[model samples]
Target: MSAVSAVATDRAQADAAVVVAWCDELADITAEPGRITRVYLSPEHARVNAVVGGWMRDAGLRTWQDAAGNLHGRVDGSTADARTLLLGSHLDTVVDAGRYDGIVGVLMAIRTVARLTAAGPLPSAVEVIAFSDEEGTRFGKALLGSSAVAGVWDDGWWDLEDGDGTTLRRAFTDFGLDPESVGTAAADPSTLIGYLEAHIEQGPYLDRAGQALGVVTSIASARRFSVEAVGEARHAGGTPYERRHDALLAAAEAALAVEGICRASQHIGTVGTMTVEPGAVNVVPGLARFSVDLRGEFDEGRDRVWDAITAAFDEIAVRRGVAVEPTEVHRAPAVFCAPALMDALRTGIVSTGEAAPPALFSRAGHDAMSLGLVTDVGMLFLRNPDGISHHPDEFVAEADIALGLDALAVAVRTLTERHGTGPDGVS
Candidate 1:
């Protein structure tokens, strides 16, 4: 091998070890005593910003915390005419979270920007943003930080309450931030060239394919609903099967129907949460409430499956003699990666002396979905073992992270050079 190739391989290995150590360091700043549970606008949030902000400054970048609580770092380009490229991902984690999910992406970007700056003048000013909230474990509102940056913050989100009954508005104030000033976090769309995020695949595809990285084609379109089944309550023993209208039975059937339809349709659906009313053990359940999370690659196809599921649910409700009602609580359309940015990432993966990387559509929603509202977005994914995530067992190899750092750094440079000299400029 050439001397240059050996040096590059060494750098990837060293950087991977450093980032894995950094992830371990951040995992210790959780609210729970022995688990990872960092949420939005809590003490952990502030502590992490300070910790990562110091690292950002050490990387020769100016750092600051946005009004919405997202931490940011910037390294300027060589020329005044140079464009800006956005990088990085969320810093928050879900309850009892794994070490890599959102954290690895941010650390990878920090190292990428450091590499770019150390190589001398760049054609674009690279900005690394560690968005404060993505998991929404606290307020039950995901992408809060990126939504603010995209200028899509809703006025009604302030009323959202955590499990502890503290209002989001109050939590903001307690975190030493004004609820009204979140608008200041929005970036002008004109200033950004595009957004590129490096994240763990959070699925088994890359590992199964034996690839270290993949380029994201798109983030899934998602819809969520709260479903309820209501029926007459009666004594469990006294009520005959002929006269029974058991809500719990009907709700269970509905949940099963969702699973069946999604499986047959090749879409993803989950009845993640469910509850039944009546405290007495001898009493039949008269009310059952459950949540349905449905996701797919396109809007129309996803909605079609929802239609099929709804029809199946209605049939189950009638057969069981219960009233079924479903309320749509949240919806986000599909976000596709730009072809140009995809090419840049493709170029980067190939630069690592590997074969052309495979492309995959993300089933999990990301902050990239929110950022896509304002600008073009692209993502590169490292392999996650067994596709485990949002759990304590989720894991990624250090060697994969090392490869990710090298790929991401090259992708940023490729993008910057292309955008600077492109025919249209800053697509």
Candidate 2:
């Protein structure tokens, strides 16, 4: 779940009461639709599909669900063999999610289609994809839905299991999908024009800049690790300070070092999970484990930050007389926006009468990262006050959504005008 998974889950673990309520609701899956906690290939997933699919039809698009369970709605262009333009965001959410993180993008997309088709069919066919999984909450693998559409779905992922040990393959069958058909979900790269997604900023940049929208320049290059610090557990009362090798203390310092290093580098790092062994109040903790997520706009800069963080950890471990170990669990390279699409977005925003729209590099991952494999990708971000996302506090002003609808529609038109006659619609 934690691409921002750890962002909320562990960093805000103090919100145990809120977390419990979310878990309880998810236990029933049909639990009265209180707070969003939808995971992949579950009843909650199906429920949203039906609801959103209805809106798709109302927008004058034909709807269907792919083998990987991503929901899609499409309307053809006037020309024969018209290139397809993809628009959308994920429908799935982290536990106790905010209403708009992915939902708004999907809704805006359908509305954008309505605005476009109201005039006439676009030069390129338009398809809106409500990606089934981007949080990787259930199977601990992000981008399952988009990866399938990108034609990069891995068969090995079938064995991935949830907390309850339900393999992804089993979940597919349980959801009434054939695992063998997952490969069919891939969209033909030649036919696709590109993928554009409009999402909440997921950071404070736009809000602070006082801008309603920004053209995303790229998605962060990210790496996630499970880190461990080891020492001997001993009696708290009898052990002298000089003889103590407290692993927990060392891990704590490492966490602080992560913040310090990343802050100075203008990158982002999160030590989201931590656990200390031997729960007794009188026992000196001997084993400490934590999660580290490091991200930056560029790979080299991000990796440099990681090396610096590791060095800081090694120094802390030596000083605390503990051994530090880090195991990498996940990594994604930065996905840059298509220059033409970025320009289209820029023109689209400017068309809305804004002289200058900000250009930002996202620190959070999105469905675009996977879609980047199949086609050029671009993103438009709406302001979220203080960039607090993944929680209930995350928000986008209604006015911003209204403006975004116009902006995205114009952006699509700009794209169509620029590359309508091209085979791939890439300018």
Candidate 3:
């Protein structure tokens, strides 16, 4: 190999070692049940964060906590007023959480900062965060910390109840974090030149495509609606089948309709969740309720899907002679990141002699989506073994981790050089 090729190969080998060490450290922090038992809200989560935070300190990063309990570690730059490049991932996990689901991106960022510090003088500031909550395991509200930074967190959010009936705000206080300090996490829109998040692909697309890195371009929006079908309760044998105003039947019709809508929409729709209440074998269901979740890359596509679903609901109500009502549970607008940032990430991947897949949107939500509203945003997905995530089996290979790290480092170098504000702030 030529000198340049040899140098690149050496870097790749070294970065792979870094990835292995990171994973080993995480395994040491996790529990044996971690493979099968859910890691959500366990003391183990906090333990790992503490250990990672200690590493951050040892690396000479200045650390602090916000009101939301988010941990921020700052790496100073040559320019005093440079807009900071923020990188982070959530620490919490779903039950039986995979070791690599979140901590990979965070640890990669930490390692990158450590390497940069050793090289001396950075063009722009870098801030690594372990966002307080993104998995929604504890509070059922995803993107909690990032929402605060975007200035979208409000009183209504404070009132949301957790599994223990504790308000999110109260939980914050109980955890020694003041709710009032949430505002301190607010980030100025322009001063944040860009936010980058590295995460496991959580899906099989990349592995099948034989790629290591994914450049995320947009985030899909979600529209969730709860539907209730009401009818007179009757004993299964007592009600004549023809005379029955069966709520359960109406719900079944609606469920199939939702599936049909998704199929007919040419793949622009999805109905991922449904539930029916008063579940009993003997009792004829007088009330049946379920939720319809719709996600799309564009607003117009989502509206079209919604129209189809509601139209089906109306038709079902008419045929079943039952009342049907749908209440919107949540609606999040689709978000697109800065095109320049996307281009830069692609460039970075190519510079490392790795292929960058075309940009794609996340099927699931993430903290980066929230930050996009307040800053330029971009994302990278490290390839997971089976494209699985949010579970204990979620995983990524060591080689893939190194590829992702090199791409991220390249992205940082390119962005800082092109957009660094110096001591003047966002210049």
- The models' CA-based lDDT, in order, is 0.88, 0.84, 0.74
lDDT of 2 by residue, 1-427 (tens): 1011111122113222332343333334432366668899988899888878987898799999999999999999878877888999988888888777777788778877877788898888889999999999889899999999999988899999999999999999999999998889999888888999999999999888778889999999999999999988999999999999998989899999999999999999999999999867998999999999999999999999999999998999889999999999998999999998998888777766677888999989999999998899999998898999999788776556656766787888877655555665574
The per-residue C-alpha lDDT of model 2 at residue 332 equals 94
Candidate 2: regions farther than 4 A off: 1-33, 424-427
Which candidate should be chosen as best, given lDDT against the real structure?
Answer: 1
Superposed by TM-score, candidate 1 places the C-alpha of residue 108 at a distance from the truth, in angstroms, of 0.3
The local distance difference test score of model 2 is: 0.84
Off by over 4 Å in 3: 1-12, 20-32, 35-45, 266-277, 422-427
Instruction: State which candidate has the highest TM-score.
Output: 1
Ranking by TM-score: 1, 2, 3
Q: What's the TM for model 2?
A: 0.91
Candidate 1's TM-score = 0.96
Q: Compose the digit string of candidate 1's lDDT tens values, residues 1-427.
A: 2111312367778878889999999999999979998999999999999999999999898999988999999988777766678997999999999989989999989988887778797887889999999988899889999999999999999999999999999999999999989999998777778899988888899888778889999999999999999988899999999898999999999999999999998999999999998847998899999999999999999999999999988898889899999999999999999888888888888778766688999999899998899888999998897999999999888878887887888889988876643235344
Model 1, stretches more than 4 Å misplaced?
1-8, 420-427
- TM-scores for all candidates: the values are 0.96, 0.91, 0.90
Ordered by lDDT, highest first, the candidates read 1, 2, 3
